[model samples]
Structures are given as C-alpha cells and as structure tokens.
Target: MPSAASSEAPSEASTAPWDVHRLPRADGKTFLVTGGNAGIGYFVAEQLAGTGATVVLGSRDADKADAAATSIRSRVPDARVRHIRLDLADLASLKASAEALRSDRLDAVVHNAGVKFDQPDRRETGDGHEAMFGINHLGHFALTHWLAPLLAAAPEGRVVTTGSFAATSERLDLDDLESTRDYRPDRTYGRSKLAQMLFGFELDRRLRTGGSTVRSVVTHPGGALDSLTPPRPPLHAPTTGERLRGLPAGILVQGKEAAAWPAVRAVLDPSVTGGQLWAPRIFGLRGPPGSGPSAVIWRTRRSRPACGRRAAT
Candidate 1:
C-alpha cells in the first residue's frame, strides 16, 4: 500500500485563511468518495478528513485505501477517516459496497470515479458492456441505485456526480448506450458526461416528482487542465511501439484534483444546489473553487454550450 498519503501542509504563501479552520458536522454524517485512492479523489478525501469528517475512501484495492487513509490522516491529526473496497468495473463489487454502506446510513455520496476513452479497442466489463460507458456510467448508475435508500434516509443528503464540460456534445444515441454503433473518443466521452449531467438533472426531477427531496447535483471540470482526464489509449490496436497521437484542444485540460473539487464542494459545501455545476478557473487548468453556471447545457440526450465555476483565486 502506498504509505499513508502525506498531508499537503498549507504553504504560508497560499491565499487561504490561516488559523481559521472550518470543519463540517461529522457527528451524524457518513460520506463516501469513489476512486478516493488517488489523484483529486485522494486530496478531496484528505481535505474532508482534515475536518475530521467520517470520510470513507472507496477504492478497488484495500491496500491503496489503507495507504490513502493513512496519508490523509497524517495531514489532519484529528481526521476520522477509513476505507471501503469498490471496483467500478464489477457489478458485484458495486453491490457489495452499497450493501456495506447500507449498514451505515450514507449522509452523502460522491460519484467521482471515471475513465477516459482511448482509441477503439475491445474494452468490456463483467456484464458485457464497453469499458468507457460501462465503468463511467452504468456501474455508477447501479451503485447509485443501490445506495438511493441510504441517501434518502438522511433527508437532505446529497449525491454529487463528477461531470464535465466535455459533455457539451451535440448528440447522443440512447439507443447506443454501449457505443456498439459509431464511436469516437471525444463524442463517446461527451455522451457519457452528457448522460451523467442529464442523469443529475433528471434525478432531481424524479425526486421532486416523487415528493422525496434529496439534492442531486452535477459538476463540470471546465477544461481538461484541471480534472486530469486520463490520456487516450495508444492510437494503434496493439498500442506497441506507437507514441499515440495527441488530443483535441480541451480534452486533457485539468488536474485530477481540480476535477475532484466540484464533487468535493458539492458534498461538503452547504451551498451546493441540485442540478447545479461547479469547477475551477484558469480555463480549466486548475484553481480554487467558485460558483457559476456550467458551460455545458444538459440536453435530454444531447448537449449545447460548455459551462462551469471559476477560481476563487
């Protein structure tokens, strides 16, 4: 396991307030962040841990989870954090995580784990679905479905799903949720992101329609600079000896930590609104959190413009 993640000791040069701590009420809250083992998920878990929140870092590897928890705890001496093993690629694991979490009412959940699309290859999941859509959308959908009861137990509990301006695609094929038909990395990703966004908005509508009020919000990492969308697979089929070509303008814009922020804030910040989006500034490079409309418009099955939050810095 990676040694307990080292705490990011605040630099004296940082613009954040010094000696002013803002910890959430952890007394009754139990939160979970999928893919909390590394990248932005780790730091988001870390910052939440700093507040002594009962944060659970959901990961596929138990060792990684332990390492992440240890590392996060090191940063916040009083952190009350732990781990839970979950693999988005497997439906059973998703069910297990949900079942385990059901034992403890989930005060909040962050559906932040995702995979970037690579050049076309036979990427399949246990349930026979394409890798990108399967892991990114279906698995998350199942997990959310499993945990809905737990979230609802908390009345005002929140569900924050990581979305992207990349979702601003112009079209979607509800008929082809698996991308069995025509596939392009950009449009595929955009479709998934669009699905997540619409899902977020639709979830809210469903809840309201059902007369149950749990806030379901979505966020966009405006540019690729911050969210740290993983790079594409090698262009070649075998991916051998090939340098793999580059990406479009905004594809690889943001850092993973920056991408994780919107989800983090969505869960921790009391101000987060259902169906609303948040992100960093720097044209998606990376920055502190701020609020605004998302650059991407949520379409039933397609999208329009891009949108997101700005940096407080």
Candidate 2:
C-alpha cells in the first residue's frame, strides 16, 4: 500500500504549486506509458521511474521496448521498469496485451503512442480503420475498456490521454470519419488527434456519471522538437550541431523531455481532475504544465458521441 503522503491529493491552496522536477513519491504505484520506446513517451516513463513507481513501457516493437527499458534502468539504477507488447494498430490483440500486464492494479495509463505520415499517402490499420485514427484513438479506447477492471481496483486510478496541439484547429468529419473521401496527410492526422481529445473528455463524463473511481485526463505536449531534446544514448543522441541549431527555436518550442511534463503532471498531480486539459504554459507552445483551453470542436455534444460511436465501430 502506498503511504498516505503518496496517495492523497495535496491541497491546492495550502501547498505550493506543483513542480515538475520534484514529483510526489509513488512507491507502490504502477504506471503504463504507451509509445514509451521513444520521444515524449520515453521521457514520461523515465520521469515516472524517478518517483519509485513501477513504470511499464508499452510498444509494438519488442526490441525497441527492451532498449528503452535498458536506457531508463541505466539512468535510474534501481528503476522498476519493464516492457509490454502493445500494437495499437491491431485491435484484436489489445485484449491479450492488457491481460499480459503483470500488475494487478494500475494507477495510471498514459496514452501517448500515435502515428503520423509525412507523405500524402493515407494508410489504414490492420483493422481497416484509418491508420492515424485507429492507432491514436481507437487503440487507446479499446485498451482502456480492457484495463478498466484493473484500474478500478486501484485506490485512485487515472487515464491520461496525450493529445496534439494540431487538434486545436481541426474538427472531425463525421460524414467521412475514416478519410476515405478526402484525405490530406496533415488534416487527417489532425482530425484523428481531435477524435482522441474528444474521447478523453467523454470518457471522463461517462465515468463520473457511472460513479466510477477511475479518472480520465487530457494533455498535449506543446511543440516538442527532437533537435531540442537531450541525448538518451542508443535511443536518442542528438549531435551538438543539432542542439545549437535548435537553440533559436527554443524560445517558441521545446525539447521532447519538456513536452513530457504535461502528461507526467496529469498522471501524478493529485490536484488534476478528470476532463481538464493540460498543456505547456507559454502560448501552448513551451513551459511548465498548466490548464489550457480545449478546442470548441471537442466541447460540442454532437462531436463527442460521434467520436465514441465511430471508435466503437
């Protein structure tokens, strides 16, 4: 059992503001971070490990997942970390993957893994849904359903969905949800992420209505550029020139390490309630985690139900 100091939510008015650098002790808690093999997910996992919690990295690639776990253990010598095979693209396999999770109780699950294609070509998941929408939205949705029992068993379980800033300017096209009619790489990706944001909020609404204990929170990693991020050995080793080049952009954007702050805060911050949006403080671009405005598209009643129905189908 976690100590009272670790599990209880700190008083917002009495306690000092939450600090990303110094997280509360989570000795007996367990957290799962999807896409923990690289980018923002890796940093989220690493930071969570520092809190004495058991962190599980969920990825499709077994080797990459192992490498990420190794990198984390190297940094935090006694870090209790492991990897799980979680291919979000394959809907049928998510149940097995959820079952394979060793922990009996899950304190939190960070839905961070997503797919984005640079080329104009539109891809589809093995389940026949649009690649970005399927993996980014449906995968996490299904996984949450399967993991609900474990989450409910915890003292205070949380589900943190990592959305994208791009979603702020986009709206889901219910008429063509899969982008089979008019698909532009960037627009489709943005719409897919929007669907995810809506799901996070809707999930919380339903959870509260059902009188469930689990909380669902939404977050976005401002503008996180790889060039600005620090090196993590085999996982990521940006050259000095790259870091220097990214220095100028540092004023507006930040490294992936910093971007991971919002998700980490959403997961561990006891004060953070379900259905709230957390993002970087500076123009939703870079800085510490704080409450941010959610897109009007996600707030609409029609869109939320449509998103849930589409993902269900």
Candidate 3:
C-alpha cells in the first residue's frame, strides 16, 4: 500500500479537485486495465498513458485494443501502450494472459471488464458457470490468484475492482455460486457484483493477515450512460421513449470520463487503502470521486471501512 502521507501531499499541492488530469507523474510505472477497448476502461488507459505510464490494454479483440492504443497515441503523441488479448470468460485465457505478464512486474491491475447487463436467458461460460458470475467475479478471482505474486513483487502494488450499485440490492449466495437454479438475469448480475465486493474486501483482509503491502480496492461508476461517452462502435441506440425518459435522468448521468474517476483514484491515489470503496461525490450517481464504505460490505451508518476480520464476509 502507498503511504497515506504521500497521497495527502497532492491534495495540498493544488486547490483543484482530484481528477485524472491532476495525477502525479507515472513515468516508470506500469498498469493493466481489462476491457480497455472502450468505455471507462479506455478512458482510464488513455489517462494513465498520458501520465507516462506504460499501459497495457487487455481485451478479447486485438483489433479493438489496437484502435484504443492508437487513439491514446493520437492524444498523448508519445504514450507508451501495448495490447494483450484477454477473454475473461475463459479460464484458460486468463491463465495465459497472466503468463504473458510473468516477466514484468505490474504496479496495478484494474478489473474493469465485465458483462454490463445480461441476456434474456442465463448463459454459461466455458467454465460452466453463469456468464455474469463467471466473467465478473470468478474470472477476476482466478486472474488475481495467478497475478498476485507479480503484483506483490511491485512496491505498494494495487488491485482495483469495478463494483456496481447492484451490490447494494443483491444478497450474496455462495452456495449458489453459479446461480444454476431459477436464475434471473438482472438478479444474477447483481449477485455477481456483490461477489466482487466480497472478494475484494476479503482479499484485502487476507493480504493484511499475510503481512503483504498490496492493497485491494473497489469502485463503481454509478449510473454512467453510454450515450454520454465518446463515439464508439457497438453504439447503444436508445429508443425514442428511452431517450425521452433519459433526458431527466441525464442530469444524474455522466459521461464515461467522469465515471472513470473513482477507479483511477483507487488505483493511483496513495492515500486510498485496502477494503475501501470509492464512488462519485454526488449521491454516487455522478460527480468527482469520493471515498466511503460500501453499503453491503459492512452495513455501517458511518463511513469507516471494514478492517481486519470485519472485512471477511
């Protein structure tokens, strides 16, 4: 974990609110962001690359990763970025991607790739698990297992997981790990997100117990809409009524750039600690990054994070 004092300096260094543009130099550091082809992931990768970090864009599609890297280069003329083919739905691919990084130590790993919504019917991955649970939770679980050693090798290594508001509504049913019985798409996705929170906080507890400096932090981009993001492929064409209703909701919705703030803060901000959750400042729907405990993780009225055994679910 980075020194709390070091992270505090930047706050006093400037009067401007914390954002990606204000991050300190990252010249020699390295970061890997899953789902970096587009959305918040792409923007995060671009922001880090702009800060001189060697960013690796992990995506299932090599072409899309290349395009994202090219876009980053176009913006940061000298940005050093690379691509690694990663399919979080496949366990074998996750292992292979980890192996590809074996020779290099990583400063941070951003678990940003996940199925945003779900299909009408529940689907399973090659691992024979529910699609959302398999990709969002288990896949990242396995990836962290495989890469933890590499991350541990770095100074104050960090792991940042993308969580969701769904966690606030869903209950974690470890017994039904795959949601094999009467699975509802939305509920299953919620359960998966809750699992993500559990895993992240639990990992922090384990790391602390094991006397490791690595930190595990979770963040969410609340109510961010694709309509507010940059133009990209796989455009979500909202229906007329959807747009009509979204007009009022748009006040609460933000672009992907704003959505990426909390995750970026969790990953790079030295003051942030393990087991803490970050979200937007305004009702967690939109605004600058803010720190707090997840409602589901500890169910506390106070903002204090779960520490030690309390972090264990």
Per-residue CA lDDT of model 1 for 1-313, tens digit only, reads: 0112122221223223222135454555778888887766776676667665688888888887887777766667878787777888898777788876645478788887888867766478887888777888877888998888888888578888887767655446655676776677777777777777677777877887898768887765444332134422121122222212322434435444455665666777765667555566444334555555455544433222235433221
Lowest summed lDDT window (length 10), candidate 3 = 1-10
**Which ranges in model 2 have alpha carbons more than 4 Å from their true place?**
1-16, 295-313
Model 3, 172-268: lDDT tens per residue? 5544667776588888888788778778888898999999999999888877776666544332245566546656766887878778888888877
Q: Which ten residues in a row are the worst by lDDT in model 1?
A: 1-10
The per-prediction CA RMSD against the true structure, in angstroms, equals 11.4, 6.9, 7.2
- Candidate 3, position 192, lDDT: 84
Error of 2 at 57 (Å): 0.6
Clashing pairs in 3: 1-213
- On a 0 to 100 scale, what is the lDDT of residue 200 in model 1? 77
Model 1 segments more than 4 A misplaced = 1-25, 222-255, 281-285, 300-313
Q: What is the TM-score of each candidate against the true structure?
A: 0.75, 0.90, 0.84
Error of 2 at 4 (Å): 38
Mind sharing the TM-score for model 2?
0.90
Q: lDDT: which candidate is best?
A: 2
Best by TM-score: 2
Tens-digit lDDT string for candidate 2 (160-239): 99888687566666667888878898988988888888888889999999999899988888899999998999999989
Each model's lDDT comes to: 0.65, 0.85, 0.77
